[model samples]
Target: MIYLDHNATTPVDPRVVEVMLPLFTDQFANPASKHGPGREVTRIVERARREVATLAGARARDVVFTSGATEAANLAIGGALAAAGPDRPRVLVGATEHPAVLGAADAAAAAAAGPGTRAERIAVHPDGTIDVDDLRRLLGPDVALVAVMAANNETGAVNDLRPLVEPVHSAGALLFSDVTQALGRIPVSLERTGVDVAVASAHKLYGPKGVGALVASGDAWARIAPRAHGGGQERGRRAGTLNTAGIAGFGAAARIAAASMTDDGRRQRTLVAQLTELLVGQLGRGAVELNGPVRARLPNTVNLRFVGAGADDVQACLPQVAVSAGSACSGGGDVPSHVLLAMGRTAAEARESLRFSLGRATTPEEIRTAADQVARAVQRVRSLTQSTPIQDEVRDDNRARTARPAGTPA
Candidate 1:
């Protein structure tokens, strides 16, 4: 099968596996223990922390390991709200944020014991980036946190976070970013961007799954209370036994990504362009519409709407080529993409969209083959549907006027 769904998860690099194997067999002691074996494992965990921190543009002491980005997001959002108390009982999250962030904010607001916190959504532009004006309008002293991701997982649209720092800080709120999709695919400098708290998953960057990090500034940590209480691990911020093997693999992945990210990004960007051009060329421009920004996006990702063709039908036609209709976390639901809906797409338009995310190992040859297969699948699906030619044209025109400007080519 031709796998084009790297956004869901990536294959672990062999080098990362090599780094992890030794830990599981030879050095499996708990990092929290005080024995010599435990001390040795602690060193390994610390080394991984530094590597992850370096990639995230954060200090080593600021990184806290978690099971994955979802857990990290919960810790960040829940902990922040818990610490802020009832006086600052509001969180402003991006409308297109991952379900983890959105759900965390909602759960925090609905907490039974604490003073009620409200979770509001900041609107997004048509191209999927956060609307800073809307964010500014929503900011207030009562707002405790603002969540705007660095890059969108479905559309690959990037946000210019520097423009938001001043406004968020002025309102006495911390800026939190979920960089799970942006960490290795694009440059992410949490400290440089003034993002107080950021979360990333190792699996997104070719490391083992079940390992991720939450990097926060000193002040942000001071405002965050511990969610999990146990043996007082992770500087007392998170409590659990560390995954030594996964942490080592995460470090190896970060080290590799740091050295090759630029080259990898450049190569993947070319492949994505090639694939998109091939699809548009074969399917005709009107039949295909770009779902995200034409620029200021992740190099390895693209989302497109095949006009008049349902994404589920297209996928069913091309079983050999793996792609996603929306966020993998959505569990293959028939529901329309909330990200697209928030960006002004109709339910039908959202269902017609498909996401193609490339990986470091994706090649020009695979791009050509996948493009041919997808084109055939789209044509077959369109023909099978009973819509008339005039209806298709009208739908295509409406999509162009709403989703993309009239002059722009798909």
Candidate 2:
């Protein structure tokens, strides 16, 4: 199978696995222990911390390790709201945010103590990028946090977060970003971008699953309360025994990404363009419409709308190509993509959209094969749906019904 779903998760790099192997067997001591082995393990963890921090443009002390981006998002949103107290009970999140961020904001708003406390969605442009004007209009002193992701998972829309920093800070609210999709695929410096709190997962960057970090500034960290409490790990921002092996692997992955990201992005962007051009050449430009922004998009990602073909039906027709109808978190469900809908697409149009995210290992040959397969699958689905006599009959009946006067007999 040709895997094109790197936005969902990436295969763990062998080098990262190589670094993690010894931690599970020979160096299996708790970092919290006072013994020599434990102290040595602690050093290893600290080194990994520094590596991840460097990639994120954050201080090592500011990184809080978590189980994954979901947990980290919850911790950051919940902690930010908690620290702000009841006075600042409102949360403003981007309309196209990940489920984790939306859910965390919803939960916080639901649990809030005041009457007017709630979570509101900031609007997005038709290209799926956050509307800075809409965000500025929504900002207020009552808003405790603003969550605008660095890049959208489904549409690969990259937001210019620097445009939002001043407005958000002026309103006395913290700016949090879910950078899970952008961290390794693009250059992201939270400190330079003025993002107060950001969440990222290792699995998105060729590291092991179940390891992510909440990178925050010193001020942002002070505003966040610990969600888990027991061992006072992660400098009291998070509490639990560290996943030593996974942490080591995460560090190695970061180091590798920092070194090779430029080359990887350049290569993947070319391949993605090749894939798009091939599909459009075969399917025709009208039949295949690009869903995300033509510019300011992720180098390895593209979302396309196969006109007149349901995404699910097309996927069913192409069993070998591993593409996604939407975010993996919401995949396998009948619901249309919220991200696409937020970008001014109708429910049917959203249902017709599919996301193609490439990875470091994707090749030109694979791209060609996948594009040919996708073109065939889309054609098959469209023909099956548009040529059926039953569908024609249904369309005729619908047109007749509409033409008839209201309340008239059938």
Candidate 3:
């Protein structure tokens, strides 16, 4: 299959795998152990921490490894809320945030409720960009944290976070960003942006899954409480045995991403543009609507809505191409995309949308083939709808059967 769902997850890079192989075999000793083998393993883990910190533009000391972005996000939100005392109990989250952020914010609020503690959702513009003005209106001294993503997983919309730093800091609130989709695709400097807390998964950047990091500033860490307790691992912020192999791969991926992101992004942007143009050209501009900003988006991502065609049905018709109607984390539900709905799309329009995310491994030939196949599938589905509305046909058949006399045949 032609994979175009890099926003969901990427195939592990072979170079990253090569670096991790030795750790799983000869160097399998636990980092926490106090032996010669353990000291060597501990050294490797610290090196990986530095590599990850470099990518995130954070200090090595502030990097805390976790299972993945989901867990990192939970620890960041929950820990911050827990430490925020009863005076500052409000948490503001973006409307188009990933499920991890939304769910974590809800759980954190529920777990840390006081008299007025709650989680509020910030709104987004029609172009899928966060509404900074709306966020300013929502900010207050009582707000402890603001959760916004650096880039949207579905639409690839990039947020201008610089404007938010002043407002959030002035209100005595911390800025937390979920940078899972933005880390490798774009230049995200947590230190430069003054982002207090940021989370990213290695799998999204061509590393192994089950490994990620929470990069928090010195002040941010001071405001967070430990979520897990055990052997005092991760400096007591996250308590668990480190996955040496996965962490090694994650560091390698970060190093590679740092070196090659410029070239990879340029090439992927060309491919994505070609694929998008091919579809819109074949289907006509009116029939296909772009969901996010034309610019200021990830070079490898695109979300499009095919008018009069259900995204599920279109996806079903194109079995050879791997794409998503929405986020993989949302599960296989018939519900409309919350991201699109929050961006002013109706439920029907949201159902008609699909996201195609390219990667470094994606080829021009694959783009050509995927475009042709997807365009044909959309046309076929639209034709079927025109010829016989499936719902109407089913209803008509039911009425005819009900009206027929029972057991009329002799």
Candidate 4:
């Protein structure tokens, strides 16, 4: 398959896999053990941690390994909220956060127990950028934490977080960014941004799944609380035997992504521009409306609305190419994308949109083929069901049906 869904998850880099293979068996000892074997395992894990820290502009000691971005987000939001002390902690979430942040914020607010300050979502524009005024108005002394994603997983929309950190700090609120989409692909530095806590997953950067990290600024260990309190691993923040092999792979991926940031970004941007031009230029601008800022977006992402098309129908038509109509987390929900709705898309427009993300392995030939296939599929699907009935018609994967062009009904 010609995969175009890097925003969802990426294949593990061969180099990363090679680095991790030996660790799984050769140095399989538990990191907590004091013997030579354990020492070796612990040492390797620390090296991986250092690499991850370096990617985020943090010290090795500040990196706390978790299962993935979801857990890391929970830890960052929950731990920071817990650290906020005495106050009925307030948490702020971006209108376009991944479920990791949205779900974590919900749990954190629920944990507030009393008539405590609750979490609020920052509004966003239809292009997927956050509402700066809404963000400014939301900040206050009672607000304990402000959480915004560095880049949207679905739309490739990049959030300008430098300003976010300052106002958040001015209000005595700590900023926690879900940098899963931004790290490695974009030049993100914890030092320059001044965020208190940031989360990232190795899987998003071509590392093994089930390994991620949370990096915090300053010495806030006293305030940070463990989500899973058990073994003393991760400096008591997370409990369990560390996944040494996965950690090694994460480090390998981080180093590769960090070292090649500029080049990789340029490559992806070129691919995106080419892909988008085909969508609008040849297909007619009315045929496709690309989502998010044309310039300020992740070069790998290209979300488009095939006006009058059911996203699922279009996704199914391109079996050889892997792309997503919505987030993998949404699992083909019939409801319109909340992110799109926040961005100003009517529910109708949101349902008609789909995402195409490029990555390390994507090629020019595959992109051309994928775009052509999508155009043909959209024409075919529109032939069968018109506009409103299309959703019901494409419920099955193999019922031979025809579609006609509706001239990009907006």
Candidate 5:
């Protein structure tokens, strides 16, 4: 199968696996313990922490490991709300935020404001980027946090956090970003962007799943309350036993991403352009409409709407090519994508869109094959829609003949 759904998850790199294997075997001791074995394991964990921090341009102590980005997002949103006194009970989240952030903001706000507060949504532009002006109007002293993702998962539209930071800061609100999609594919420095808190997952960067980090600046850490209370791990910020193997793999993945991002991005950008142009060329420009900004988007992602064809039907026709009709987490639901709708697309237009996300392992050969298959699938689905009435007429005529009285049709 040709895999083009890197935004959902990526295959674990073999080098990452090699780094994690040792931890599962010889380095199995708990880092919390103080014995010789434990001390050795603790060093490994700390090193991984530093590597993850380096990937985000944060200090090692500021990085809190969690099960995944979902958990990290929850911790950031909920913790910030709880720490913000009753006076500051509101949260403003991006319209196209992942469910993790949007849901967490609602639940956190409700818990903080006693059913009086609901999370407000910031608007997006027609190109799928967040509207800074909308976000500015929503920011106020009562707002405790403003959650915007560094990059959109479906469209891969990267937001320049510099413009958002000052506005959120001036309002005395913290800026939190979900960098899960941006961490490996682009250059993201949390410190440079002045983002107070950020969350990322390992699996998005070719590392093992079930591992992620919540990186908070020192001031941001002071405002976050611990959600899980147990053995006082993560410097009392988060409480849980560490996933040593997964953390090791995360560190290896971060290191690799840092070293290869420039070259990888350039190559992937070329391939993505090639694939997109091939499809549009084959299907006719009018038949294929690009969903997000032509530039200022992730090099590896392309969301396109196939005119007159439902995304689900097209996907069903091309079983060999793996792509997403929408966010993987939002799949299996019949509704059109919220991201597209927020960007001014009609429900019908949203339903006709598909997202293709390339990755480090994607090859030019695979891209060619996927383009051919996807183009054929879109054409076939459109053809079926156009021919359905004639097909139904033929079936009805056959039935009428079969039901006619014997020898009646002279």
Candidate 6:
């Protein structure tokens, strides 16, 4: 199987696996305890924390481990808003934000402002980057926080945070960047960017799942209340026993990603360019619009909109070739992509996008195989799908067509 959905999640690196295997049994101790075994786990967890912090160019004390990026995002958004105090605080988020950030902002606003405090969805440009001017207009006395992703997960567009951050700070509104996509894959430093809070996940960087970190430099955690109140872990911001194994794995993964980011990026771009060339050559012009600007996207991600084929049909047809429509959180639910909708794509166009996210293990040959499969599957789905809803995608039926190549699998 040619797996291409690295954006959704990635296989644990063999090294990460090696690091985690002993923790499951040998390092069996609650990190919260003070015993020798517990202290040993705590020491390892701190090393992981420092490594994660280093990747973000953040101080080690600023990092707090969580179950995953989702939890970190929630704590950042909800916690920041709750700490904002009274006044029916305003919460703003980018249109293309992941559900975790959006939902966190929603919950906080709902609690603070009753039902009507819906977050203002700042409009992102067609290329999937945010407009700082729009954000300036949206910022106000009531606005408590602004949430924007560092690099969009679906479109891979890197948000130019420098401009956005200045406006947000000038407005006295704190900004939280869900840098899960940017942290290890791109050059991100909290010191350089000056974002108030940033969230990152382990699995996204080839670490074990169930672990992520939130980095905050100042008293950013003061206003945010805990979603759960129990143990005094995470500097009393988050309450729970830490996932020692997951944190250890996360730190290890981040270190690897930091060291190899440049190399990985070059390889991914080469493969992406090769595959996109094949797609454009095989599929006619206007048959595809690369979802995000090729130049601005994350090197590892490629979101291709098959103009005349069902995303589900394309995905279903490529059984051994694994990819995703949008976020993996949409388990079994075939909803139109919110990211594409934000990009001004029609429902059909949104339904047509397929994400191919490369990873450390991806190769030139793998990309060619995936590209060939994609071309064939798109063509097959367009020809065979009997549904009238999809027929509208046909640009010109009168155009000459060729039969599927003999080598394509049944």
Cα lDDT listed for each candidate = 0.91, 0.91, 0.93, 0.84, 0.90, 0.84
Candidate 6 accuracy as lDDT? 0.84
lDDT (10s digit) by residue, model 1, range 290-323: 9989998999999999998889878876657899
Best lDDT among the predictions, by candidate number: 3
Per-residue CA lDDT of model 3 for 1-410, tens digit only, reads 99999999999999999999999899999999999999999999999999989888889999999999999999999999989989899999999999999999999999986888899999999999999999999999999999989999999999999899999999999999999999978888999999999999999999999999999999899999999999999889999999999999999999999999999999999998999999999999999999999999999999999999989878877768999999999866899999999999999999999999999989999999999999988887787745676445545554776688999652
Off by over 4 Å in 3: 386-410
TM-score of 1: 0.93
- Candidate 5: 10-residue stretch with minimal lDDT: 385-394
Each prediction's TM-score against the native?
0.93, 0.93, 0.94, 0.93, 0.93, 0.92
- How do the residues 121-187 of candidate 5 rate in per-residue lDDT, one tens digit apiece? 9999998889999998888888889999999999999898899988999999999999999998899
| Per-candidate alpha-carbon RMSD to the true structure | 7.9, 8.6, 6.5, 4.5, 6.4, 4.8
lDDT of 6 by residue, 30-134 (tens): 988989999999899899988999999999998989999898888877777777666537889999999888887877777677544557899888888897778
Q: On TM-score, who's better, 4 or 6? A: 4
Where does candidate 1 clash, by residue pair?
none
Better of 2 and 6 by TM-score: 2
**Cα deviation in Å at residue 189, candidate 5?**
0.7
Clash counts per candidate, in order, are: 0, 0, 0, 8, 0, 2
Q: What is the lDDT of residue 405 in candidate 4?
A: 42
